[model samples]
Target: MELGYIVSGLFVGFVVGLTGVGGGSLMTPILIFGFGLSPLRAVGTDLLFAALTKIGGVWSHWHHHTIQWHIVGFLALGSIPSTLITLQILKTFQYHDQQLTYVINLILGIALILTALALSLKGWLINTIKANNSSKVVLIIRHLRSNQDFIMISTIVTGWVLGFIVTMSSIGAGALGSVALLYLYPNLYMNQLAATDIAHAVPLTIIAGLGHWHLGSVDTHILFNLLLGSLPGVFLGSRLSISIPDRAIQITLSTLLMLIGIKFIL
Candidate 1:
């Protein structure tokens, strides 16, 4: 069983390296459906897994001067408070395991669906925002673009949503954050967007993970096995990412995630 968990982590980490999505997006689902972990336990375990895995990314991005500190700060301002509140809510329901499981599964399903849509639409959305089309969505984006204050507030609000969803589901801090940042800060380079998203996610996951730990949902032994496998997996996947057709991978991953989302909901 431990070896199975390690293998699962390796597979998930490889995919994450290739796709640059968050580990929680894949890991939590695998823990739930694949390994038969309770939803709350899966979420709790994955949150800490994500926090630990992403620390190196944050350091690398910081060294490369790719991270946007102001943006991270803005996101943290909203996400931190929201995380605390969400943790409190979870604590309140800790005794009701069935209800907690149901809520986590429902939210996880929704988050996965949203992440899938974000992955599918990201390219088209970015193009549409850049094009000189007179579409309503483009017009709204343009309006938001012109209003710096609104954009700043919107970033914070995006963080707030991510905080609540990620605390409950452990699935939104990466893909969803990137999509929102892409929409709000169209001028940002992809690296900058990714770096900023990761920078914010680390702290959010840590706080939430610790809260879940306090609630006794985390499995340290499972987490250790996963990390042991995932580190090398990520390295190998990243090395091979240069050779693969990213569009194909994204499409397949998006489809898989959508199906998983539907399964969770049903």
Candidate 2:
């Protein structure tokens, strides 16, 4: 691979570190749609790339005692079996590579739309949750709990669909999933919500990455290249996050996703 190719990895890593978004959403699409990598290779490599990065994040959360194991369990409950079904889906269609490209295009479109919406709606959601703070949200915050069965069933079903989509497209697991969780548990403490999402992300990405590996889709060299930049990128972004504004980051990410989506669609 050329040093320029690795530069894409570094740039993507820097953006991911700065915004905590767009690992698969931006990277895989750029690889396939911009750089013209095969969709199969892009998805596989990005899956492993996500897993590796999230492991580091999970460790940080664990050390801080910030990980919400309960929420993670709920998300895993939804995502794991779905991941298996996704693996099966990939197996059936692995030979029909062209269709996979179309799917990637479609997913790139959807991911962009969702990320844009998430970016705009996140501020609204946070504000609304704060302004119209209801007893239900307040109660949940005071107790910091969720109904057991609801969480489990939701998790499994959510995981199932996301698993299939993410495995097929390498999109949705980041901003989309986080946004979904935020809506479902509108009352959740934001920190706890982030912690839960990251915790959930670990297993979801790992399972999908392994499945891709089994299918011979993963490109380990590419994955390592992504990690080389993303790890340090996260640290660099943290240093700058305080100075940069959240709304600006969100808007920029949304716009980037939109542009990428339009490119894929057209």
Candidate 3:
């Protein structure tokens, strides 16, 4: 069982390192279906795992100046509070002995389907947004921010919603969030978009992870073991991504997510 988790982490880590995608997407499912961990526990442990692993990626992006601090600030504005509220809700539900397993399964199923859609339509999504460029909306967002009005409030609210969803499912902050941001901030670069999303994700995951720890949903030992294997695997896999085609990787991962989604739904 232990070795199985380590191997799973190794594979997931490598893929994340290579493509910078599919860490929580793959790991949470493996923990639940492959190793038979509860969904609550799986998500809880994976949240912390993601936060820790992504630190390295964020640092790299920051060093490269790919992360747009303004966007990250906007995202964090909402995400921080949303995560806290979601954790509180989790706490309340657990206290009532609610069906954690069933709830987790439902959320996981939805997240997987969305992930599949995001992966499969990534190119179409990017092109569609670009084709329908909205300079007006860009100007509106910029002006609202510039004017120091309620846009900050709105951005935080948006972040809060996404943070709750991501904490529950480990699904967003990937292709889906990227797509939304592209539309909202048409002037943002792809690299900048990616970096900002990572920056937002780190804090959300940490709060969620801490909540899970309080709920006894995290397995510290397992988390450490998984990290031990994943860190190196991620490093090695990132090195290999250059040799692999991006489209092929996205397609394969999308197909995998689809299968998992359908399985859980049934």
Predicted model with the maximum lDDT: 1
Off by over 4 Å in 1: none
Error of 3 at 223 (Å): 0.3
lDDT at residue 148 of model 3 (Cα atoms): 40
Instruction: Give the TM-score comparing model 2 with the true structure, all chains together.
Output: 0.88
lDDT of each residue in 128-148, candidate 1, tens digit only: 979898989889889879999
| Most accurate candidate by TM-score | 1
Best first by TM-score, ranked: 1, 3, 2
RMSD (CA, Å), each prediction = 1.0, 3.3, 3.2
Looking at model 3, which ten-residue stretch has the lowest summed lDDT?
Answer: 140-149
Candidate 1 minimal-lDDT segment of 10 residues: 16-25
Give lDDT per model, in order: 0.92, 0.75, 0.80
Residue pairs with backbone atoms closer than 3 Å in model 3 (clashes): 78-156
lDDT of 3 by residue, 74-148 (tens): 888777778888888887787443486677778788888887897788787566555545677545545554544
